[model samples]
Target chain A: MQTFHFDPVDLPPGIPAFRAEIRAFLAREMPRDYPAEQKANCWTVYDADFSRRLGERGWIGMHWSKTYGGHERSALERYVLMEELLAAGAPVGAHWIGDRQTAPAILRYGSESQKQRHVPRIARGEAFCCIGMSEPNAGSDLASVRTRAERLPDGRWKINGQKIWTTLAHRSHLIIVLARTSPADEKNRHAGLSQFLLEFDTPGLRVQPIVDLVGAKHFNEIFFEDCIVDAECLLGTEGQGWKQVTAELSLERSGPERYLSSIALFFELLRVVGPSPSESVRQAIGRVTAEIWTLRQMSLSVAGQLARGEDPYVEAAIVKDLGNVFEQALPPLVQALADDGIHLEQDSDFVRTLALLLQTSPSFSLRGGTREILRGIIARGLGLR
Target chain B: MSEQRQILADTADRLFADAVTSRRIEGFDAKLWQQTIEMGLPLLLAPEADGGAGGDWDDAGAVLHALGHHGVPIPLAENMIAAQLAADAGLELPSGPVSLATRVEGALQQAGTRFDGKLLGVPWGRHADAILAVVPGHTVLLRRTDATSLRHAHNLADEPRDDLIFDNAPAVCGPASDGTQASHLLALARCAQISGALEAALHKSVEYAQTRKQFGRAIGQFQAVQQQLAQFGAEVAAAMCATRAACRAATRGDASFQIAAAKLRCNLAIGFATSTAHQVHAAIGFTREFDLRQSTQRLWSWRTEGGNDRAWADVLGARVCARGDQFWADLTARDDAVSLT
Candidate 1:
């Protein structure tokens, strides 16, 4: 038997080609007027035309079914494309969540009409979706959502609740909301809730931007006050909202993207600062690289499991738990590397990247469930109480 | 490694639990040793030609993992590795309790045509049919009956480990050369054993943290405890990683620098596991009556033999700095390559 468990995963075939394609497209079509700071900021900036062009290449909904205008690619294939784009600072920002998570969930459990209406436009980059799960009262406690959706006399459901931390809601065309249809249902607290594809411009719908500590307009608080929607806007089945949302969170969490977000920095660090590194620096680099490789293997193992159609919830959590640490480690590590006179000042592109990542890495733990919560999940799965 | 090993480990574990109690260790558990020999363990290093399975590092590591898992008291690593060290040195290794002799430079020795020296901490030396002790110019293979003084220097693990004082032992009982003999081979073998013990300890720690509850939760559910187990697991893994890498170097006949690395890494692992395991096991672990005592105690002693961490680290540091020379680099490239199954 082979002793070494870790088999280094290549960043899928066609990645280098895809990378070239992205570079060529960005060079030719992208405006030279883009601020140097904004360009350096990478995929966080939304450019609809750039996203639409990417969608024209069938890159937006690359992992969805071809019938829905998707490219009909493997998750790994989509991964290679997205990972390369993210690493190279491609403007995937506009279509990021729509293609990454929301579209996939809709395809899996959305109504046929919902798929027909949303997916084609999503593929064409005409629509963007942000998740509506976290509410004012429920941050990590997702099941405690009180976003009530009551059936009205006009036969439309009226949703009246406020959701906080709704990323990109101001820019997104639609938001997938999980609302409680029956708070009185004792049989299942989670069962009475249902998901909906809500129009961002619906009457009584308002979005207030929540500026992060970094001063980026990344997330928002959305209030739905008597916002009525036809029953056709209902996603999947009623009362399966909690189960559906949990499945959606799985899509949010697992992937090489979780760790690969820092690779560009790794590449940059190696290039500008190779040879004759200090003992501590060399050891740190070696240690971090080995761990990165290990995390990649474990992540691929989970991907392989997912490819085989296994839910692999426990396995996925294990990868995410470990992967997040690597992500969270990158900024501080890059800073440490930068501190050795590598020059990570605001004016330097390297410094700009470092500043952005260092500002961003802390939230890696916050984004996909907190560190403590995921460890709890792992402990429970391992039967370690 | 896990599937085949779990079965072997589980089997031996059940039997070891029955025999080899604390009382069995202070005395010669001859029946258990005979049982292990019958079970084809002692011949582990004896090669296929010498009525042995001819298993390498991993095979031995698996058995050691199993032994540590159950706290089984038998010199699985020492007996076999010691025998191989003598064979590789081209001297007939006397079976049943032979000690490999170390040669120190700039040291006073009675200058004589007959190579005479004393060997210390010889694993299983007092019970051996023959002993291979290295003098300045020769690996003098001595018959146990021929040794002047062989006293049992009591070991933490109840097995027989002794210092063999030699007065004119026989020279080159086997065919290998004297200049070719080195303790690097012994260090590599000993490192494998220590790595196995570390892995076993981590596995036990994890198991204990998982099931043993405190204040209505598994101790592992506590982040402090989880962090400890996690770090311990990583250390054990790193040690195994280095050990397996060294094994690959040995297989490719590039065993110089790797021996030091494996020993150094394993030494670090043994210290951590022996200590952390008790923290997980807590008070009940203090009982020599408990199985945890066996593995932890062995870890304490193994660190002292075949050169300790300080000595190995110096050797490791010296070799690593010199590997940049082109010829040395090419020679040592394969040294760092190990099968990390």
Candidate 2:
């Protein structure tokens, strides 16, 4: 078996200057009295204005080419910006997907015209994108997707399919859809799939909200019936959608976002427990802190390997899988720690934030990829399958 | 890694890979110990002016990591720490292996270059040439011949862990050392060792799972085994990353929280790796006939050597709690957080 490498990664020498600039910007831009619950939902708290402000500072799409409105920064520079934004609980979801994966996808696979059209707008935070991968029956088994896209006589594509669990579909200006371009071969089930970029304004396409277990409207169910797209919208070569989508998913899974979803509650727990806490509370906090540090280092190593053009797919999967465990285990432990007789004022910011975090903790594992699927990928890399 | 560091690590790996076999760790071999010392393994962390390699913590940490991977059954790690301590105290480095102890169960009294105490759980204390003890005021080096008696013991790996009684023993004492900081430094050393052994345990388990057949197929084909191995891989990765950072912090001489966190994390990784390794190997892993026990048992023994998860976790938790509102700021601002040392 090939050995998995996770060398230690150091931020660039000038990272402190970049960190200081972001901190100063965040201090000046973030609201003075933002709601406590908002911090708990920072990843899903869409704010176009905040994203645009970050875009104005050349923070968004910092790793792409300058010709496409990017700042031509290193991957380490982008990593610094992302960690700082997540640590402060910034509202960056409005442009997070586009800046993170969609823009990179276009830059990597799209035609030059496509790059000039979408990459510039995404970098400016004036456009947004949502992924279309999961279907009603193909949640974990992505190769079983039945969405069909047929070539039309007028050189356009006609699509008919339903995508489920599409996050922020209604708000996005474009949807990157995966569909079957030809009949599936029994020998290679992953060969016949293809990808297309569909605008949200296309007729016969509808997005209906899928409210989560918590009373939040972050997910959607999109229905496409005879939805037509121009011939130029196809991403990369035809029949290579599975490969492109898998590459995009790698970018989705390997980032600071995977592990920092529960950090706000940790800060709140500190505020509530105060100084000189019991041994149990201290142990819990210490364990979580150690785990967080380890995960960040692992993620950073993956980022470093990615910067050097290495496909660290197995290591990235391991990070997301372990990251989910850390994030999911926090709320229950925090609840047990605070279950003592001490009464928390109902309106206290600490109590409100804890309540919100406890409600939303379950979704951490379901997003990006489920636990079982990620482990399966890890097992494949380990040569166990 | 620098070329020099890579060469040091490679040399250690080759030497220990031959000296450390399943047959060797079953019993102590004094000849193997002498061969190790002849290669200047113990002096890797000492100053150049003191007739040593004069390498930093990161350099020595790499060497110790390679030795740990081979489950080398000598006092190499302890001797490395002792030589550094002796250098810090401005004393002549000893000729043989030295064990370090910053705490003792019984009272240690000093009177005119003499010490009296009962030090417990000293690793390889029976075979050590000298005992480097950092007392409340001064750091003293006592020869093994001065010990009044010895109560021999063994850890999970069957390595010597002896208790020594010193009654008015003559010592070469030096200036006072920071006892607390010394303990934290030892903890960092132990973390480096544990991370290396964890990787070995994981590699062995994965190899076994692929080769061992069950029900007409490899056991690794089972989902249950695959999932367990995946978790073990994550634990190894975490331990290795944390240990590397702690070594860097040690080189900077500001290893307060980094060392504590690393020790705690490595201990946790050891717990998961040892148990899962035994489970994956089934009954064969429990027997001393197999190489898995060498690594797993050493992990079981090393986690509690410098300080276990509980001890270091308490120190780490107290520091974080004491920071109060400054916690978030310090955590995000790596400079402020690390400089708190």
Candidate 3:
């Protein structure tokens, strides 16, 4: 049996001061009365100015090389900055995709021209990017993506397909899309797929908002009707999109964000429970505290593995699987333990936060990757498949 | 792991494998205990000046993890703790198995050089050469043969958890040293044990799922079984990380929060790990003859040995709640602020 390794990772030197700096930045920038409801979905809260401020601090794309406008900081330092932001419920949506997914993909797989064009803009928080992997039919079976990018005779690429659940696509400056560049191979469905980078302002491109149950319009559906781009837009080698996108997922799945989504609600719950709580309430609080603390350690361990240039794909999947369960279970557990006033007092900060999380928490397991898909990955890691 | 820890872990893995084979899962295994003593395993945490290994808590934790992983039936963790506590208090102990008791039913009255009290749930008390108890202000070591009466008991794993009564039993006493409390050390020990046992259980379940056929194919092929085992793997991972982090934290300094959190997380992992292991293994796992029972039963017992989930949860939750808005700040401050080499 293949065993999972999450060796304990100590935060590197200067992390405490780095953490304090982020805390101070958040305290200074974020309003004291920032709505609790908004904080519940803080990462999805788009604030261009806030993201720009973080970029100004050299916080975005922190682990990348300085040649691409990155600060060349350690992954652990970036981890500290991220957790501090999430804990404070800072709005990081505007640069979230670009800094987390696009810039890294470009740095690792993109040509020098591609990296120079996108990575610097991303580090400066001037260009926001949205992912284009999922389609109406390709949710978890991402290998079945049918979006096509055909190389034109004139050495340009023409794209045509629809990408669904593309977060903030309408507002994003660029979209990194996974499309089939050739006929799919019967032996390997993952073959023939390629990734393309396109500006949202490109011709024949359209984005429509998909409102969620919480009335949030962050999710978007992008239509590529022969969207044309220069040949330089093709990311990495042709037909290696599967490998490239899968690599990006380890980054997406293992970060502190996976577990800290509902931290705002947690802090609110603690504040409401006060110093002295009933035995049951105390136990509830303690259970969640332990869960979050352990998850943080697991996340950090994965981060350390990544910094050391190890591919911790299975470990990353485990983190997301456990983290989503912890974050998703928090709202209801708090509801059962908290006073009924949360249900009646809709205007109160605690109630508002709890209500928002109750609706949004379901998406925690749905987005990124479904619980079933993540489990499949972990099961494969266990040598079960 | 450091090279020193790697050597210790390898030594422990070999020692436990040779000493506690599958045939001797239910009893003390005196031959194994003798080998353990020969290796100076019990003095792993004692200072070098005290004629001991002088290893740190992480080293001891690595040994305990191997013990639990192999389902070794011995009081090695207890003995290590007892020897270390004795060394810390400047008290000399006999070179034999020594069980530790942090939970005393009543006060250990010290009159001159004798002591009287009940040490509750002393692990392998009847078999131990001596029992160490950390009282209110003193660390007291008493020979098991001096006990007035002994009520022998066993945990779910069939490990001895005897209660010993002492009435004016001749004992060595010294002032308790500052640093980690006995209860915290015990809890951390169990965390390491549970973390190891969880891995064992996960290993068993995954192997079973792959081999045990159902519906004309391996059950592991089914998404349902795979998902369950995957969740089991995750719990095992969490337990391992939490235990290792707590042990590392203990070696540095105050680890109240890490120990409490580790114990609580390990306790939670035990529930899911054991249940999932059984569910995946089906009837073979439920029987007494299978080796899975060794790891699963130990997990069941160890979850509550040091302090149960509710106990540690209370400590951790109260601490976070008391911090109020500063909880995040307090949590972040727990990490060391050292420079990178």
Candidate 4:
């Protein structure tokens, strides 16, 4: 593991300068009519063309190699870029998963030709990808997924079954899916699973948006009646899908995204409330700040570990488990602080963001594996499981 | 910065785990107490030649963190705090727990006729060679073997929190701490212990949340309970950061505002984390059969022991007000080594 020369959360001098460059670029191309609220932390409302703009600037694949249209930047540089984007509430949501995680996976585990085929387009944000891990019945029990992919005569794969809770499926160009390629055996339930990279417009593929509790069409149920892909589209070897997807999940779970999503709303809550806080509000905010700050340290530590090319699976689980708590806490704390006649959408972008966050906060703990699954991982790490 | 601290912390963690869990710590464990004394933990503040440990706050912090982590039943923190105070008074480190050598009369006025003020709840006082007691303006060291001791009652968690009546027992008297010095050190020490207990408690809570599934999923998956775990996680981490930082300051002999901040943070973190551990786990955490109670119960007692949220907040408020008057440069002095790392 690479020893962290300093805290991973602290942006390097090279990156703060990079931040200035990106800010200037965003100020210019963000479109005067851009949904400014999209720039608030996790509340980034999806805008396809805007995300494509980011891809065109090579901002989407900031850490990928230049040979792959990636900036070949240090992980710390990526850290700076991701935090700034999320903080500004950029509408990068359309291609976030693909650019931040899927592309990274392809770069590391995909064949060289596969990297050449997808990396550049991903860098330009023209190609978007969605995660297909959560199925209707196997949302948290990833090993129990029933979506099946079978090898056909022509060496192509015929995938049949359904995937649900696939976020932003309607807008993405492609999806990275986890499928069961074998029957469940006496071994661990995770055995026999496989992964596939399928195009959105594939002959048998269908996308139906899954409206969340807040009535947003951000997530969807993707039906694979007979979705077919060439053998080259397999994410990894058969039965190796479990390991590859796990590595991907760790990347998905460990970033600064988990916590920063609520920071904008939090700052808004403070501003809408007042200068001097009530005792209860003061205590709650103090407690919340302490937790968020500590989790940031833990998350950054994991980032440092990852920068050294460490998997940090357990650390990532810890951050996810802790982050859900932080995110979930914000809605109620915001409500409690703003109980004095403040509305979720009071003709202000800030209020609208709070409304959206309140509607979205409940899923914070449910998405990306349930709290129990995460705790199970953490327990095993602590030797308690 | 030093490996010696890790050695001391690891050793103490092992011994305390064995002793506390074994129920060998009856307010104090004599043999283990001597082992700690031999480790020179008590004389950590003493000069190297004075038969003391001569370690810094970082060293003391490691020891305190271990004592908390393992739920050491004895008042190791209190004894250590007293030792530091006594040593700073240009005196030799007495063997065991000091009743803080504070005036029983004043404590009685505060306690409203409940001030028999013998060193009850005193760790190793049940086994100390001598009890450090302070009269109106005098600090006295009295032998425990002199029949000058009286017993009291056991506390809620059964730590032997009785009373001691000095009645001017034949003892060596020195000088009392002029004002709130003893109180401050005592509160800071308690905060450190509480931080450790919170850490242990949160760990137990997380384990339970992951393992105990209902409705076909671990209860932790539920948003309500996950919120509890998350809150405790944050508090536990915050308390740890604060407590360790404060312990660092105390060991350096600086005892700055950061110490007060640490104390305040730990007080709230422990209070909330412990209560939530019980709430989230519900019946399981409430039962004495589990290890969760061990840490939570200790936290409950420690909250009221050295100080509570209100007391620490007062200290925090005063410190902030103090800074409000200092020149901006002084208040935000860069490299104020006293600031937490």
Candidate 5:
């Protein structure tokens, strides 16, 4: 039996100072009059100015080496900053993808020239990146992606495909596209796929907005019509997109962000519930808090594993799966507890936040790999599939 | 894991595997309890000068975890709590098994060095040499023999949860210096213990599912069963993390909202863990003849022993509400700032 390894991780001495620093920075810089529902939408908030400010403070790429314009802080310090930012509902989406995924991906597999070209800009938050993995047909079954990148005679690649659910693609400066570079093998569909770092401004590329349930234009459909990319654009070796993307998903999965999505709503619920709450209300709040705390611990443990250079894919999946379950469960539970029948309006932050969360939180499980896909990963990890 | 902690855990694991078994626990083996006491587990959290191992809460949590993993049918956690309370109060530590109580149905009133009241659900009270109760400003340590009478009871695990009455019994009382409330201490202990039992349940369920075949293949190969086990794994992991974090707080004598949250979370986890384990094993897990009943039943029993989920939830929810806008700050506060509201 392969048990999940969520060993308890003690925060290092640097975490407290880092936490205070981030909290203070958020206190000073965060928009104070935003709607409470906006707090629940913190992760999706694309404030390039705030992101630039964070980068100037060297908070964006603290874990990266100073040679790449990073501060060379520990992973735990970065984790503290992330948790504080998420908890404070700080807008961090502008440079989030680039800082979290693109920088590391470039550092790990990019050429020396590619690293020098992109890594420093990413650390400086001067550039933004978006994931170009999911397509209309390849949402969860990623191996079925049909976006083809053909080898050109001029030592470049011509890509022709459409990517759906491309978050921030409309604004991102770069997009890490996963395309089929060769014919797919019948027995191994994961083969022949490769990753490419395509500049978003490339010719024949288009991004169209898709409004979500909350009437927010956060995601978009990206079209690549014979887009040309130089040979230097490939992220890793050809036919290894499956492995590289799988690794990247780990970075996307296990984080405080997974569970803290609805935390701002939670705090608003607390404020509305007031000092005296009924037994059921108390239990409801307690249950959510317990679940979040546990998920945070698990996420931190996975972070520790990542810091130690061990791939905790299964462990990360479990954290995301469970974290999503709790986050998704919070809105309904709070609604049932409030039982106020109050209309959603700006006058009542609690009522408005609750309504927004109730409508939007269903996507929590659907967004970061659906519940079924995550469970499949867990099942594979358990050697059951 | 540190070197010393690993050694302690390894030793405890081996000792538990050898001495504590289904047959021994089903038969209520006194020798197994004696062996555990002889191994110096009961005094693991006590000071060295008081005939203890002088270990911290993390080491004690490891021992309790080992005992819970093996489904040891003794009040080892209770004993450790009693020993620590006694030692912390500068009182003489007594030999043999001891049980600690925080929520007695009847008042255990204290006057000078005497106490009078009925202690309900006193774990291992029938077998314990003494009972330690934290009342008012003092920790009252009273002998079981001094009790007027004992009404023996059993939990789902068939462990002793006796009711004892003390009619103005003499006790060695000391000023409470532990700072942590008895409920918080016991909650922390049960959190660790339940985490271990939850792990064992998941471990056993996964093993059983892999070997137990269905229509064509192992039931574990089925997506339904695998998903259930995966959910169980999540609960177990959550319980482990929550308990360890709460234990860290308890070790620093900071009985914050975390203790209540951990207790509530772990109790809730045991519900899922036990149900999923039983569902995975089906008939075999339901029977006492099999080893699954030991872990599941204890999970059922231990969850309510030290402040059940509802009780602890109220504690946490009230504290969070009281803190009001400071909820996040308090939740993320350092150990020194985490006293019970």
Candidate 6:
């Protein structure tokens, strides 16, 4: 049976300085009075200007080739940039998907024309992308997607289906839709599925925002009614969508964002509790800190694997699974250990951040992929499946 | 892994596999100690100029991991640390088995080269030719024969953990070496052992899951069983990674944070790893005849040894909290000695 490997990775030289640069940028750009509650959901807080500033600093697509408007930095450098942003709770939502998933997918599998048009715009923070993989009937069983697309004799592709729980679809400039180009084969449910890149302005596309439990409108339901796109819109091979999307998911799952979601609240907890805390509180903080520190090492190991061009999907799944549990548990742990000075009724930063995270923590495991799905992936890696 | 380290690890693993028997689960195995001494395993961290192996902490970690994996009932880690400490202090080590003790009760009084003190929880104290006790600002090497009395004790795994009382024991003493504390080294040793033992338990659980039948199907086929094993695999991976980080940090200087984090992380993983391994095996695992008990019992014993999770967590947490807003900065300031390609 294959075993999991997460070799320790040391950040290359100059990374410390690069980290300082990002810290300086955040210090200069982020508002001094930015509320902790908003920072708790910073990744979902869209700020086009903030993203553009990062783009200007070449932080977006910093690892991609300069041919596509990238700066051609190392993957470790990009990792440092990303982790600093997440750790500081900077609003990176506007171009997060574009920079993280879309540009990478395009660079790896998109047509030259697609790369030329989308990669630069993404790197420039002028375009935003939302994934359209999850459907109303296909939450975890992703291959059960009922969205269908047909190629017309005139060479344009027509798409018809609905995608639910699509984050930021309403505000995104583009959508990467996974559709069945042909009937699903009984022996291979994953076959015949194709990915397409479409502009939000497409005539037959409609997006409706869905309010989350936290009253956020980032989640959306997208409908594709006879949406037509040119043949160049096909991403990668016609029927290799499963392989491509799973690769994207690996990139999605292992980043620092998975575990650092509640970092803002963690800092707030430290701040409110002051330098001297009770033994129980200190123990709680210590436990959480140990987890965060270890998770960062795991995440960095995966990042190093990616840099070395090795597929560590199983390792990534482990990180996401462990990270999701840690993120989801942070709020309640803080609530259980915090002093009585901080309560839900109070409007203090600690209280507000704690409340927001408590409401949003459930989605920490739900988004990207659910805990069950990640464990299934890990089990497969362990040769149990 | 480097080629040299890999060879050392393989050799250690083979030696440990040969040494560990169902009957020798407790106490020192003299033949195994003889073989290790012949192999110079105890001098792994001593400088080459001192006629030692000149191996670094990483090399020692690889061997220690193997020792733990096989549940080798020996004081290899303790002996290695003792030899390295003696070498660093320019003290000549004794020929036979050497146990280590960092936590001594009361003061280790030194009057013109004679020492007196009580060493507590000393692994293999009665079996060792000499015992190395690290008191504040000094490391004293005392012959076991010089002890006034010995109280026998054992951990949950049945390994000898004795208390030795020394009254004006003739000893070789030297000033404590810089950047090498007996406690931190011992903690790192425990972390490496926990890492290896966790992996062994995980391997056993996975193999059992694949073969054991339930409801006319392999129990591993069940989603419930698969998920538990998957979680087990994750804990094992985390322990391994954290231990590696700690080893690497120790190879560099000032590894207080990494060591504390790694030990705490390993301590936390032990609970889940032991429970899940036994849970997956069900009733068979609970039997003393089952080999799974060897790894689980060691894991249980090692978790509390070399400082438990609460102790390390309190240290790590207080340090970070004391840093206040600089917590993130301190966490990110990497002290790794290697460069990424």
TM-score of 5: 0.95
Model 1: per-residue Cα lDDT over A106-141, one tens digit each: 899988888888889999999988989988888777
lDDT of 6 by residue, A1-385 (tens): 3367887787788776677788888989986677678888588888888888888888899999999999999998898888888888888999988888888998999999999999998998889999989999999999999999999999999999999998888889988899999899989999999999899999999999999887778989999999888998899999999999998898888788888899998999888778878887887888888888889899999999999999998999999999888888889989988746566989888898999999998998988999999999999998999
TM-score of each: 0.68, 0.96, 0.98, 0.73, 0.95, 0.98
Model 6 chain A weakest lDDT span, ten residues long: A1-10
lDDT of 3 by residue, B88-123 (tens): 788997787889998775454546378878999888
C-alpha RMSD of candidate 2: 2.2
Q: Please write out the lDDT profile of model 6 over residues B7-86, one tens digit for every residue.
A: 99899988888777534546888888888989999878878887778888888888999988989888899988988898
Q: Global lDDT of each model?
A: 0.65, 0.83, 0.86, 0.67, 0.82, 0.87
**Compared with the true structure, what per-residue lDDT tens digits does model 5 show for residues A1-385?**
4367777676666555556777778879997676667778588789888898989899888888788888888897788788888888888899888888888888887788888888888888889999999999998888999999999998899999999998888889988999999998989999999999988778989999999877889899999898988999999898888999887888888778888898888888888778878888877777777776677768888998998999998888888888888888888887777677555553687887788888988888887688888888877776667
Candidate 2 residues lying further than 4 Å off, grouped into runs, are A1-3, A342-345, B105-112, B335-341
Measured against the true chain A, the candidates' chain A TM-scores are 0.88, 0.97, 0.98, 0.91, 0.97, 0.98
lDDT tens digits, residue span B46-86, model 1: 67765566766555655654565455555555566656665
Give the CAPRI rating of model 6.
medium
RMSD (Cα, Å) of model 5 = 2.5
User: Which residue ranges in model 1 land beyond 4 Å of their true spot?
Assistant: A1-66, A69-96, A120-127, A153-155, A184-189, A199-201, A333-346, B1-68, B71-341
- Judged by whole-model lDDT over C-alpha atoms, candidate 2 comes out at 0.83
Candidate 1 vs candidate 3, lDDT winner: 3
All candidates in order of lDDT, best leading: 6, 3, 2, 5, 4, 1
Candidate 2 docking DockQ: 0.50
Global local distance difference test of model 6: 0.87
Who wins the lDDT comparison? 6
